[model samples]
Target: MRDHLPPGLPPDPFADDPSDPSAALDSIEPAQPLDAAERLAVEEDLADLAVYEALLARRGVRGLVVVCDDCQQDHYHDWDMLRANLLQLLVEGTVRPHEPAVDPSPDAYVTWEYCRGYADAMMNVVEDD
Candidate 1:
């Protein structure tokens, strides 16, 4: 039988990878749980989100609407719901097991333009005051 081996073959993909499972685990980055500062920052952001949510709610709005970067759709997620989604995304790399729709009133959900205008109006009022 004649040999059909190539003179020079490409390197194997798993050649560098550890063969022993223990060694492989050693190379893997242990899930360093979120640091205290990171957790606090995330919580702070959540709190700010609650403020935005409250503003919307105060105007008879049910929830804050956001455009999904992945879906590119205007998703109406409320304060806690959005927080939950964000947490899930952080943990699972996505909002898996997807949540049921908790649609906020469309009329209540204002655009960024409206919020900015409202802020400007408030600023004007404050300056006058």
Candidate 2:
């Protein structure tokens, strides 16, 4: 039976033992806990997200577009989708699956940095008045 498996793949020690107590343990993975700093960052992102949505949506902006580091591509997320993602991260401490907006127009979405700059400029204008 060992020869039937591909090279370097360990044969399951409990494959023949249906009642083995450790058999279930092999399939269970522990949930990773987030550190204090990571938790705080997620909270901050969620708060900033709400403000960004309100401020940008008023200027005919549909939503924010972010560049995926893993895939090296831009993903457009609608306002609700962004909220859900942030909330999920805040609550579950894990990143949900990526769900890019459907056929979003390039003109309607802006990068997070752009949104931050816009917010900063608006704040400065308000302070100057």
Candidate 3:
């Protein structure tokens, strides 16, 4: 192969060879600064997380396991981890790296939608009573 790459350009491993099996890694940028309204919303979410932890942990709910759209796999975050992430966003305007639960059981984790629905149902029951 003739050297066509620019002076300082690193050659693409698969430039001419098409069977390298290397996946392109996506570059993740830092989160943008939160506006006043967004800041308020994050604060509210943080408060709601506290309530969720209090109510759900008693029911044996460990935490949430999210299937990241980017990674296309499940990531487990315990209640404390979720709280820390939200707090970091509010304070630093950026999320820290994923710190998933260690050897988390898929059975112990619930989706965010499930938690929302559960909370809604509980609220309705409380209102009815």
Report the number of the highest-TM-score candidate.
Answer: 2
Roughly what TM-score does model 3 have, to 2 decimal places? 0.70
- Model 2: per-residue lDDT, tens digit, 78-115? 77777766666556565534446668898999988988
Instruction: Give the winner by lDDT.
Output: 3
| TM-score, predicted candidate 2 vs. hidden true structure | 0.72
**What lDDT score belongs to each candidate, Candidate 1 first?**
0.56, 0.73, 0.74
- Who is ahead in lDDT, 2 or 3? 3
Clashes of 2: 0
Q: Residues 1-129, candidate 1: write the lDDT tens digits.
A: 222222222223344456733454456554555666766666765665665565556767555566777789787655566676556444534343334345446676665456556656767898999
Candidate 3, which segments miss by more than 4 Å at Cα?
1-32
| Off by more than 4 A, model 2 | 1-31
For model 3, how does the per-residue alpha-carbon lDDT over 1-129 read when each residue is reduced to its tens digit? 445432222345565565754433325565688999989999988888877877789988888888887889899888877886787788768764544566888887888788878888999999999
Global Cα lDDT for candidate 1: 0.56
TM-score of 1: 0.47
Q: Model 2 residue 20 lDDT?
A: 68
